[model samples]
Target: MSRVESAVGVAFAAEAPVLIVGAGAAGLCAALAAIEAGAEVVMLERDPVPRGSTALSAGLVPAAGTRFQAALGVADSPGLFAADIQRKAGGEADPATVDAVAAGAGPAVEWLADAYGLPFSVVDDFDYPGHSARRMHGLPSRSGAELVDRLRDAAERAGAALLTQATVTTLFAEPDGTVRGVEAERPDGGVERIGCRALVLACNGYGGAPDLVRRHIPEMEGALYFGHPGNRGDAALWGEALGAERRFMSGYQGHGSVAHPHGILISWAVIMEGGFQVDAKGERFSDETRGYSEQAAMVLKRAGGVAFDVFDERIAAVARQFEDFKQAEAAGAILSADRLEDLAALAKLPAGRLARTCSEVERLKASGGTDAFGRTFSAGQKLVAPFKAVRVTGALFHTQGGLAVDGSARVLRPDGTSLPNLFAAGGAAAGVSGSTAAGYLSGNGLLTAVVLGRLAGLAAARLV
Candidate 1:
């Protein structure tokens, strides 16, 4: 397909106006937005495959008051979205940044659909934990790899050039702290300094760096790191060296139920439909109703870093409706049983205690009362005779902290002054959640990637 015309309908000059580092979702979205604003753009990716953590995600972006939600007869607003966030984070997030994300969320999702023809639909089955409404937009295939590919296609069609295998080492700047460009080294050990009027750091977080992980979040220091390998604290190191203000550096997102041995992620729909986590002793330690990210530490310390996600055949049937679940099942990531006792045997646990534990879970679900660990059951679904289960463990998926930015995603100094011509977005920027795992709402990752990226692009375009 031919490249789509620029949104401004103005051809870019010989020299581009914007240079973006890290050609993941943030860089690609920023490139598209800058091109639409009548600026030529160049994106650099260290990986030859041009992939990052975005490719490993489930591709859920929560957008309030979107056209899709309206079509479904749902009423929502940015105010309500902000309110929801504040409530989830206990009012610990930066008010300005939260408001900016809330306002741009619905438009960002629609823009992806209207401009790039991305196939997005609202997830309507059930709301995730901590979210009060159904506002997540995802692809038909429900794959984040597809989302990254779509963004790359859109950026290319908009005339933004993406270069792969270009490792950005550091930022070049004037004495006044104005970013001139970046110095990138080629795979062959050749270095080139690429200059631009504006530079954006979309390089993501430091998930792959063990030292940084321990420094910022000591709680998850020794846990399994499951994020993309390219994230090695480039953004944080560069930002700190440049004297950028760091906010909420302790926050991170954790996955409590990773399908191990087979390497595919088991969808949380199993838990959403009355599933529960049990140890080998067939005892429940913590509430499984908390969102995956918030429950990671609990699962790790309480369940000995290992547990089994036990669900019924009916819940499996509903979960298997999704492509990921189907693929996981086809890959032998799940075990099936005709009877609860058989499932217990497959899980290598005593059938008697497991039966009693499941009975208690069912009672809690029906009663709607809080459990000992403070988990309240919402869905009335229960585990019946036919059983399905997956052995799972906790892992750190993404860091929820990075360079702090202003309303327009401009990197700021410690005193709240914007750094000249320096911007950040996506995992490169501070997340919207509070300073811990307990505050992560569903779809916060992509919301920051898309909304902040668009804002940064437009703001940078006007400058250069």
Candidate 2:
């Protein structure tokens, strides 16, 4: 299987102590950490532009017991955070992995900000289902592209070699199952060998690969995939060949309010700030108070696999703060109207049903009672005049499954043996979102990416 091209050489790989595959949040965090720990680092990215699932995210990661949380007068603990994950996941996710990630979440996020100088702030006003506190840490621009660009710059400044447009075909290992180096296929039909004391797999999930989805996560087979096409399950494939165990293969995160034609994800914050989702029949099918990922299956099973989200001007004002929502508004994808009839006409929906639904939402808010879907709206946060609406549908974001790894981010075999000199993080490792889409706590993906990436990097550098 080794076809050595003339241009490919092992001299460069010989000098690098750590080799990271994938340039997304996980790989970049690994590179930064490994380099900071006094080791030579090199990163490989399959995409020419290097935008992976991390760039598709909202650039928010949940952290408990951070300085920001403490400053906001919100008392939170890693125990509480892990308990929230357990409750949301119904305890299907591995308890040890959840405990490990939760234990390191605050330190991982704070280290990135305080040490690497990544610009991040705790979203004190934001709230999500399953979390008792406002612990979402977001970038200033609320754009994951900015987050990627910043990490790229930071890694480069720290002297980590980032090689793009190179796809690692397979791992080079000894007969005793000790992984040694990687063989990458270049775009020009060349093979490059990069040797390292340790290899880290950060390539994201398999959302772009329909066959993989059908095999592991069958429920998301027909839905629109909003995640990057770069997530082709390279990690899982490689793991299988290396005799690694897979876990959480059925779990995923789905977005319920993806703007159909515009390709913009209407910010979930809109729903948190008094927005509502309605079907074409103009009736509220489910409670918008549920997590966006949790509502995806219901939205997809609806009559048209589409829904309209309506919000008042005040909620829209908060939504406008997000970059994606602002872009959607500028593109005329977001609709605004003062009258319910006119809004229904614009959306080609039933005006009468829309009116009744709006009234019911307000009544629920005023009465402080549980909705038909078992969702409750708080008092004094009622929707008011001048409504804004967007035509939306459900979409698969990322898979929450892959190779099962230990708490320190070591890939494990079926007998619970760690793969020697190999590590996984981000989408490559099993996530804490249980075994279904509904288990995704807000920001779980990025939180795991940051924490496990750092831990994997630090540990791998130690091995070198």
Candidate 3:
């Protein structure tokens, strides 16, 4: 597409008011928020329109304690939400950021629902382990693409210009250390420089960059990329080059999935449904029914850093009852084997070991020693006859590290001093959840993306 570098002259020219890098959910939201705040915004995206990690996501927006809850007679508060997040994260998160998210989350959700026309419904009595209330909201489309489309439309209507296939190569900064704009690579191998008073980077994580992965998350060294192909950490690298401080560089969200023989992204959540994950010797490794983050940590640490999801025909049938399983299958997130021996052969595990594991699971079910989420499984729900197995491995969705920012979304230096005229939001910013698996809450990513994006937009707009 065409790129506009300068609308007029050098200094004091009427260029785009705000330059946003990455057209994913966060970038789009930032652009829209800036435009809504009366700023002329320009969004540059490396990929084509309507495709990114956001499009490939299972969009679940979590909102806890709001006016909608009061109408539904469900009680909740920001304090309760903050307490739950901190408790679940095991005190590893930044209290200030966590508090900010809790306090702003309700209003953010309200904006998404009321202003953005996002359809939402209040779920009842369905609370996460540490949640104080049943305030989790699921999108009607249940795909991040849906939300992105909505935001893109809104931004367009608000006069924000979106340029796709525009890859930002460098971040432009003033001599005073203020970020001025970005330099991007066009589709035809030409470079375009766009300048603005404010710049926002929301280009997502380093899942696609093996070098960054090895440099940061050492435990996931050589891990296969399960994120978007275009997500090569351009934003992070550029930020670092611009002297921005980074945090949690070694942290990432590990997803448990079956590594098909041909290398495809499979969902390990299916295994938690009715299948069993075991080591090469056919021994059950970790609690299969735990939260995804906890399960991912266990799978990565144990089971030789790889495991197999063993299920039977009956169990597979039962697994198909859930929407996640269906989506997993549609997304090629599951592998199949007809018999236990065949699956063992495919997975490179010993057939004898696999047989032993199945027998143990059956025994556990009969004796009521295996619950759904670490409880004993009932005998009636035991798997029968012909078995199946899928070779499983760990993958990542997003990075938990980036530019360290405070409650106001002001980018901070390693010395904990705020950077002037430089702000960060969304996944581009360091997250509140620290290194704890329990603290890796769902919907928090999107929450921060919207909340901090708005905060950063407002903060940047006021600078003008």
Best by TM-score: 2
Evaluated against the true structure, the overall lDDT of model 1 is 0.83
Q: List, in order, the clash count of every candidate structure.
A: 0, 0, 9
In Å, residue 349's CA in model 3 sits off its true spot by 7.4
- Best model per lDDT: 2
Residue 144 CA displacement from its true place in model 1, Å: 0.5
Instruction: Give per-model TM-scores.
Output: 0.95, 0.96, 0.81
User: lDDT by residue for model 1 over 300-403, one digit each (tens)?
Assistant: 88888888899878888777646667778888878889888888888898899999988887788788867898888764576776788898888888888988
Which segments of model 2 are wrong by more than 4 Å?
1-15
Model 2 lDDT on a 0 to 1 scale: 0.85
lDDT of 3 by residue, 254-336 (tens): 66663544354444334544567887677787776555655665777787667777776665665453345566567654545
Report lDDT per candidate.
Answer: 0.83, 0.85, 0.68
Better of 1 and 2 by lDDT: 2
Task: Give the distance in Å from residue 106's predicted Cα in candidate 3 to where it truly belongs.
Answer: 2.4
